[model samples]
Target: MKLPCLSIIVLAHLLLGPLSVNALGATLDSSVTSLHHGSCDINNGETNCTNIIPSPAKLHSGHSSHGMPILNMTDLEPQQRLFWEQYDTTTYWSIANDHKVMLYLHTFSLIISVMALYPISIMLSITKSPFYIPVLTTHLIVMLFSLLAFFIYEPSTPAYLYPNNAYTKMSIILFFVTIVHYVAAIVKSLSEWVIAAGTHDIVFDDDNSDTIHSISSAHDDLDIDNLEPVTGQPFETKYQNQLMANIMANKWVNSTVCSFGYLSTLVFSLFNPLLFIYHVIFVFTGVAWSFRIGMGNQVFNVLAHFIKGGVFFLFGLLTWARFIGAWADKGWAWNLNPNDETQSDEEDIGNDYEGTKIKINKKLTMEFIECFLIFFYGSTNIFMEHMANTNGAWSVKDLQHASIAFMFLGGGLAGLLCESQVVSRFLPNKKHAISFNPFGAFVIFWTGILMSQHEQEIPTSTIIHSQWGNLLATAAVFRLFTYTLLYLKPPTNAEPTRPFTEAIVSFCLIAGGLVFIQSNTETVLGMVYRGIDGMFTLNVTVGATALLMSWQFVVFAIKGWSERS
Candidate 1:
């Protein structure tokens, strides 16, 4: 089905490319020389200009997600023009076009992720189906990773500050990931079915019913006490059984789960090469979020992080500069409250700080906060996903819902197929069950979504008669509402965590070992065992004092010379 569909696509492109020259941006009427901004070289009025198509940024005018984009391919510097010309043509789109493509792609990926999968049936039925496991697992990992930036982390604390195409890009990646996973599952299952048809003797000792009956085959009338039978190899002779052993030995063990060369190729699909390629674009766009995914690129990673640090520092300086200007004009600091309205739409009420000489260094504060949010969004989501996939006892429906009494399922059936313990014993993927904690990962995604969707107190919204208090209050309310829902309700439809910061928090953390120790506390006579603190307040002295007394008692009373003897 896919092959035929793809064939049509290829045929259509080839047949249409030449006929749609104008549609393809090869407008010949405009003299190509006018395109390049460099000194237009005019020779006898025949201006020499490059006939290259303009980037969306160069062609487009007005407000874009990435500020006012300068649209015109010819306006690019000579080096940039050369760079783009050498770029691969297989898939080439400027920022605006890319965003459109992303919208389509992500929808598809999400659909793919929703379906339930049959790992056991797939492993048993497919012929040469080894490739599916690795492909599926890699697609799952990278798509999930990429989503961290677009929907969740970036939305909450934008590194580049929004209107950029990151969210759109993220949606597209996830959409494709879903499509790839679904298509791969179909292929894998069919292949497995083919393999199983030709292959024989996959069953183990349990397959031999003759042995199953023989142990119980003692005549029904035989007394239970006298029914003891020979337990060694059930075959009448060893010669017959050796043949069975040979068939079993030749069978593919690892291949039973995934096909050859699957894991290695799948690993490269998104982050490594895919995200690395984006570094070039990020450089031109001046964004930092892209750097988080491409950390494996050591040289680029360091360069990007440093560049981000400088951008943040410069922003801080600009904010300070604003304060200095205000102080010079009014002999005091600006205020948070808007000048004319009771409820200003600005995130920071510059008017509210009227009498104050200096601001709280919002530039530094926002920088630190944004940076922390980025690390936090990425790290915690990764951590939570790892935990769920590894430990949570996920069921098939948990793949789609919050079905369990306490825990919720994550990664859907895909997770179970790739990483669950029992399924992995029979149906393995790249990393096995070790790193897969689907519920935790889903929580990470959910958390990112909530944060990303919640708007922050940026200055621009306030510039146009917007109330600072209103903006702040709105953001705060939205934050509190979403967070409360996340905390109170378990992510029933694909498990999600309480929030990013819940784990580090402790209101009533009941340690598993702490309660057990309480029972033993009364057993000792002289030992002073201070009970666990009821509040978050410091019981530092009491805790230390109790521990010291316990240690003294143990050392003097429990460790005597007779013990060694």
Candidate 2:
């Protein structure tokens, strides 16, 4: 009975607690309602009584919640309203300024022109053909035009005026380099004229009648296998003496007017070999400068796109060059066994001799270079990504990118170790000329997947990322295919295989790099505001890449034709 009573009391309190509280609250609410009704009633018609009732306070004039100004378009002047309208809806137009457009066109034209000229000049120079000087002159003229355009039309914007900016410094350096090159070209031409006059004078000289006869006699009497017993002179002494006599007899060679010309010619001739390299750098710098101006404040983003995209772009080009036998002399034309040679009769004669076989230095192949570059890029990118953070603290985004760098570092390091001689000794196929390392391809594939899945706040950016990501992934896949097919039917000779899959790989990489650059935030926004979609941008990238590849093939063809001639 006692336990039941205790349980009953607890159940009553739990069931009626809310009802009892509600009853008391309702009584208080009625009393307050009655008091309010007495103070303000429609029957009394008392306006003062209504004012006594409490109410919420209204917002202050010209201000909204959180003390923000309430912008009223009607209150703004015509000019101010127009400015606001343009600012809100015309961001894209403002960003794509006239100066940027001019720079873009200039850079594009300059790059295309240089691309065609660089290979042509190289071929002409190597063959010492009659057209070499003219082609080189044309190249210099083009550079001069580009420099003039840059100096004359480049906007004097604050960003470009910044003294410490990299692009500004590059422009300054380019100015000096172009001037020096122009002067060198002038000196070289003058020197050539002097040398030509001297040669013409020496060749047609009738006074030196015995010169030709003596040279012919000495040349005919010279025996390569026998030396002069009494004179004990070098084999070419007679020829050298005759040649010197003819040179000294020439008035042009002996004149003081031609001395400086000859010296200048000799000095400039040393740099002539590096002209192609200089031209390439000149064009690339202009392009980079244009990119910097167009991208605005995102320096790191610009660098990321420029460097990574440039590497892949170059990789594709090199692959294509390799396919066309650019480096066949170095045994780097994808040959399986470049060092293996057929046993000739002379070699066979020494086969039984243990010490007869000569060992040659190991050749550095393309795959090894790829692995080394991948490692180097990864190692440096680790610090680079961290340093990109302005606050010196790693955010989630920084870590995310840094993780990719780590992956590259590991993959590249492993490839290097495997390709190393010490590590190769433990492998089964140690004697193979190529190590057949797939880590580089694998790293590219992983990066593609990660980039493809990378989320961006803007839908346009996301789509662009996916476009390049797919291309990169496709390129990696085809690269792997190339490796597999080559391994199965390895080419024995040091000739370009020109595998079909390699072409696909080249196209993919080139296209992927181009698309990667287009995915920049500002670029995407500009395109978006101009009603350009991802598909249009992708099509443009593809078309440009194809055009570039076609141009590259033409360059290689010209090189091949020159070599044959």
Candidate 3:
């Protein structure tokens, strides 16, 4: 009796399953058709309705001009929704795995490069070992292998293709640049070694009678009897004597190879292994992930977010580096007066020897650079903003953004003029060391205010914009404070004057830049759909910024320690 009952039930299930599925699919199609009819407009004797029903095989294939799906399960009946949900889940996992693989490969290469280049080279330099050639050779080999791995293990997805892919282009450029850098460095180092070896046997007899007599005869014009008693020694004579002495003491210091080698070493010391690796990885991750956010029809927004944000992010990092004494040798560490008497003398000597007479006012400073970049960005962005409109007519959005660009242009120009000698000559109190130009900061403040109030269709996007905007505004305020403080109590020494407010400014710019990137419409929508909130993104951004800053600090500390040792 039990076996017959089981057989009957099994037979009934087999017979009804297909019929039930077909019935449910028909019901979904009917519901979708009704909804479409209800929602779409009806013209004279004609219907203009979009078909909301999706084919089973192409449930996720429908896309809008913006590259997002036009139809999702929200418009589908229950059974259809279930089918689409399952498909989405599977697709999501596959994509996640692909991303993981790409990231893992990049991480491996980055770690290997960092380990091979950073600490080992620093130690070798400190020990003054002759194994630098081998180390560089090893690095070259590692870079070659890494490039091969990047090519071979890359994902086969269409999104990761080489042609028209910015990430791929940047990666290739970086690889070539790295190769060139290392090759040049190796050649310079080898040249120095050869020169040292060749000159090792040469000796100079400084105390020779003829040499002493020539030196005394050369200094006869500087004798006390030849100078006016009140004036002591003429400034020109003293400067010439010092310049000649320096030239005699360091004959090869101005050699092209030696200068290039010194510059390369300085660059390597500042941009250590960890910082370089992180930057490369960041470029890969940021640009590659940008494709997933869908770049079609939103090129302007994407570029604005990534490029502007990236600049500020880098600016903040450099500011932090300056605070920590990275470029102090060049007098770029934010001192009120970076110029020293000795440094000025050296510059004059170099200028005199090179026979190039440049005016002091023509020299570029950090503030001048800041103004120049702002001006450049604005001038280019004005046209870019206009390009977003395809109808050859300016929209309100275009005009609005263009107005902001105009502000930047005007402010930057004003800043440039203010820092120039033409304007400084008119001021009641003129000083070369301190700059009081506030136009750059004012531009930032105004831009932030506008952005914070900028409206968006989605609340999440608006919140994100406001978040970054507030951060930018805060940074500007802090920067103003920094300027004021510096003006009040000018630094006497040319050291890293780590203003407390600068730390805040750095954090704000970094965090704001990151948040700005996240404010893309598609990105915000995706995060919202995935239940990711603003706080989560903020926390992640802050944490990553902290980690980056800490790594930079460590690199600077190590470099300082090595130099001291």
Candidate 4:
């Protein structure tokens, strides 16, 4: 049953052929001469140079002094080969800047990473964590660098891998979709948090109760429903005090943006039905589940926030949504029941640092499905890449299908295992189950690293840069070491080692960014200034920002510890 050596060789050739084709696209060796046979033809660098007389066209004693070799035209196969052989590389369409496309894709990917941070930021802010602003700002800056990277690099992706027009359009549209969603979410959350904290003086329009500013506080006793309009007090201009009011006054801005998003989704769905549908599903589900984890309240209120808040934007839409929904649910108010004697329940007053009581219901089931889908989508691509390295055990296309199926299973497991009851079985404390919430991100990050390592056909130097897996793997080992150190220490109320553990997370992230910047430094810097990697170059920009952010997080934790001491 042994296959012939020729058959095996043919199979290998077919399988490895694409990698070779991709290699043909490596950075051009500028030192090489562009002329064919050191002679110019009448076409002067046309793709097809028909009359290719030997270089110098020196006569060799023959009937035809020109000595031009002619091939028989009767054989169609050979004719095609001759036609291709005459083609000159000089006329090939090239990217304005070779690494521009890579920069664009990388930037957009970083933006997506930033989008992922909103949920965590919202959670921390609600609980009034001191690190809220810093954490959120770090992610925002990371996203900014991502966007800058693309433009700085000028997104000149290899044309063969991606059709310029289609890829460009898709990337731009997707970036906006994510941007709008985050902005809306932020607005809604900010407004809600403001009213909840009761740190601001809310202003209201006298005649139009609904039109007056701000939302119901998380404390149910506030009785926003019965608030009386203030008659004649100067409106305070302190940013925090009137934050909600200002946002609520311009509710239509977010509404218009969301409406536009809906329209765009509808239109794009026509051409890219699967992509459009998947993205919508991801956003909807991601918001719902993340809201549940971050905000922690009744289903109805979450829905209201989602509606009022821009579907996804920075915190803006979220601020607006919460403000508008509160205003609509309960008109203009000035702390109606500030005198209530009863203590506020956890549900009524959201707790930032602790978990909220979540009911297991149909909505919860949907959320689980959504979480799985998002993870599955991210992992499938990387999984297929590794599977492709198996030497004909599976075709790339088939491996893609297999990856999807496997992700479906893995995602479901992730959803199930994340449940409190399920996690409590293995962990020392049930309360810490929520900490595993970031497991999805961990999975996605590693998948990205693996994809880069398995990626085929790039130049050796490029591959070295792309292989951030090595860095990440080392980080993982270090993380395990930190966790062991934390475990050995006696459990205390403050969890003294908490800061050090968090530093590990920051370190891993910084390491990932460092490797990425290192690998793409040349191409990224080339886009801005020829050859030189300046102090403010792409890699330097990304690396510096990452280092500063991680350092801030680490220092914040250490500072907190010192203050306590």
Candidate 5:
């Protein structure tokens, strides 16, 4: 159906005067007086700021505005959530599969890309001998499937359509595959570290017998049961060395694939994945930290690490449940019948405060170490982006800023602690670090969005709009051509192409498109005024440039196919 267009008078009245558009903390179009996005309220010169657009009068500090609710996007809409899942399967899947040629090609490309980074400065400190072989291989496999997905996947349904059949399961499977490769690698590596550290300790120790005796003695005091050696090899020189190598190879993958459930929940389950991440961290920190202590009766010597791990993990889980329930679902962790409020007098003594003051100090210590090591040191040698910026390839909106910004905080830590491997060895205690940082993501998400939005703004003109307008369009076309050329180029590249070529081509296409589209508008304005077109003639050449860039994926994919053939 055709929508009504407001006349000039109505538009002037409704638009609330010309203001620049800004969202998520970035400004767009300093020259344009009005913003397309309602959220971009006018600031002195900023496009996006915390309180700029959200006027105090319109939305009280704690209240929401008449503007779109963030939750309404998908969080509050059950059908919309379902639609996204089905869309991943029935739509993006099919299209990607259909383009299997490009899918595999890029997948292979990603493998090469990952491997290529090995010699890069980042990979040096991971291990003396590139410890990320499993990760590299897994990355390759993921790329392969990504290619299969890109080419072989079909889009039989409309945008964001939820499906109910076998396709949903298939989509879920594909989703899990990605998570399995990633999380499993981490677990394997950590596990290998445990093995290596253990065996190596025995190999190098002057008092293996004494150390082992001490540990056993401690265990006996705690009444711990014997753990059958899973290494299955006598601790002999020859066998132990061979086993060490095998274990190290096994090191990069974790034993439990519960993390696999992560992607499943992401693609199929209806809950927020943030909850899952917290739970996983809690469990990992809890169980792992427990090993640092032994089953002992003494307070100072007891398995404080394990106790700490347990408390932190458990409390975090409990806190999450309570937070989500009381705030989100308005329910308790345990359900009590609404009709059954009567309590026995004897059982009611201080019942309201049973677990309230229970603190997990031990767990908190372990969790702090866990977060510090994993988030900071462990990930430094790899992608600095904690969360992948998926949209970075196309638009300004694709970053998880907080997770990433914190990554820098992590990297700074990484620079100092690259080689140490002393590790935890036990049931955990739940303590301080056990609780989830519920609002941590909000901190990162909004900040990243703000930074990206700021970056995307069309700034005050350094060059005349008319000059750069067409140039932006032209740059977009060049981007398409260059990317297409890269695809056509053989896979045996000596190195990844330099950024300058890509940059030049993309901007030229963008400028060219802007100029071409706006030229028509300019000419029309000129005729109306009986003078040269100066104002209201949005030279739309950039429009075409942008459109072509938007469609450049088609060219890149086609070139991929041609090269493969």
Candidate 6:
């Protein structure tokens, strides 16, 4: 199925037309001009901007049905001919000429991104290694940068002051984020390479035998029960070896999300209350069951909490039932049968192991189902959502923005909850009361207000572009900062109520949310709702944030591989 390079180039030229014409930019410009200068022909009722009537040998100056004269350039005066030619040229070249700068920058950036990716791809091919952090990281950076550069390099908006250019402006910001990701990836890769060469660790075989021993440490007299390292740090092996659990949990979460996404879209389109209620119940039960799939590392653990919060915030009051069910389950677990405690320790261990194994198989099945759903229902929803707007349905703008805010708010809440879990694990004897962290509270309050806003009419595209667009970028930046603090901070055993870093990060997040809320001055029924104009900002911001957080996996890989080396 693979074509030769020359054939590929030829095909691209044939299909996309040389990539030299700046096709997309030119078409957009042409469409804009067509709105004003376009004329409809009576013969076919077809509209054209620069349509010329065919002349029969001689210059024809006949009056058409609309009383407009159909004349050749030869029949018109020199001044008239000059005006027509000027109009035609402007109509045609404004699109091509205006986008020329952007086209060059866009093409050059593509080359750069592709070049950066080539090395990583080659490395992966040569090593055939399961550890693909470096490769994954390079691809992510290249993707982020390419998308960002495309958005930012618009030739039409040179001044960059247009409020309606929300998509373009947001792209510019995201492009910068890609650069930051690239730098971070480089630093991380080198650190892993260094750490790999410095560590003395053993590798265990499939039969649970420690075959490879560290030359520096004599283990004959060492206490095998002590898992602590010589440096007194908690063994990172606990987290590194939990990749299977992370992968499983990630699959379950993704599947659960895709399921709910499809279900929600279906209900929205059909206006089926029964189906919606069933979807809520399914997500609630699914979320509860999925929580058991994780192996308790912070990455998987945080992800578990995120599913809960995301479901809660996205679905709102519907998930209150799930919360009640979860609480009841917790109570039931606390009051487990006393007779079950009489079982042998071996039996309990065997049961727990078997249960986890079964769940893993089920998660794999769900993962496959999720993939199908993404390509089928996921794609359908995107197309339908666009069609809804194009067909002049009541604007779903407010709902869209609210949904995005709820997602972030949910993640913020999950972050706070994850911190509590971390604290509880480090200090097992102390009962840690959950803090009503400001960031989570602020997000919750705003999300509540947003959820209640009315979506009677579509807000102006201008409003969505100018105000909330900027806020989306700002929010993503702060969220990324929170992730940076969470991942890059030194891992320690300190048992404080909360770290000062967390407080500072919380303040910044709250400030960003406030700025977002306040950015839009318009109020409906005394409540302000921020609306998103173009899908560009939200899509890129979410993607970049997710990818940036994934950098932690690269860090983990470095530690694990270095320890083994």
Question: What does each candidate score in C-alpha RMSD?
Answer: 29.3, 21.8, 16.8, 18.6, 27.6, 22.9
**Which pairs clash in model 3?**
none
C-alpha lDDT score of every prediction, in listed order: 0.28, 0.54, 0.54, 0.35, 0.29, 0.31
Candidate 1 lDDT tens digits, 1-565? 1222223223223211111111122211121323444433436523344643332112222121223211222344442233233322221111233244443343233223221112221222132233334444554654554443335433344333223444356456545645554444443343343243343223332343433111122224222222223456334223323432333332253233235324423533333333322422332222222212111212232233233333322222222322222222221122221121232223342323333322222111222333333344344333232222223444332332232111212323343333334674675333210021333334323432332233212212112112212222232333344345433432222112224322211110111111111111111100111111212111221233234223322322322321222
Runs of candidate 6 with Cα error greater than 4 angstroms are: 1-102, 111-170, 199-565
| Pairs in clash, predicted candidate 2 | none
Return the TM-score for each candidate structure.
Answer: 0.20, 0.64, 0.65, 0.36, 0.19, 0.25
Superposed by TM-score, candidate 2 places the C-alpha of residue 40 at a distance from the truth, in angstroms, of 38
Q: How far is candidate 5 from the true structure (C-alpha RMSD, Å)?
A: 27.6
Best-to-worst TM-score order: 3, 2, 4, 6, 1, 5
Scored against the true structure, residue 385 in model 3 reaches a CA lDDT of 75
lDDT tens string, model 5, 273-363? 3323333333222211211111111111122222322332233323322222221111121122122233333342232233332211121
Better model by lDDT: candidate 1 vs candidate 2: 2
Lowest summed-lDDT stretch of 10 residues in model 4? Answer: 327-336
- TM-score of candidate 6 against the unseen true structure: 0.25
Model 6 lDDT per residue over 1-565, tens place: 0111123222222222111111112211122223332243323422233443311111223211122222232343232232222221111113345445654454344444333343333234233233445464665555565565455444454342222323344445445544544444333333332233242232222234535322232333222223233554334443332432232123333234323544533433332233223333332222222122111121222232233333322222211221222112122111112222132223322223222211101111211221232233323333232221223353355246435444554545444443444553676432111112234334433443443342222232233233333432333344344334433432121122122333333332322232232122111100111112223223333343233223323433443444354
Q: Could you tally the backbone clashes for each prediction?
A: 59, 0, 0, 39, 98, 1
Write the number of the candidate with greater TM-score, choosing between 1 and 3. Answer: 3
Give lDDT tens digits, candidate 2, residues 102-181: 55445544554456664676666555444555676676676666655565555534443223445545556655665555
Q: Which of 1 and 6 is ahead in lDDT?
A: 6
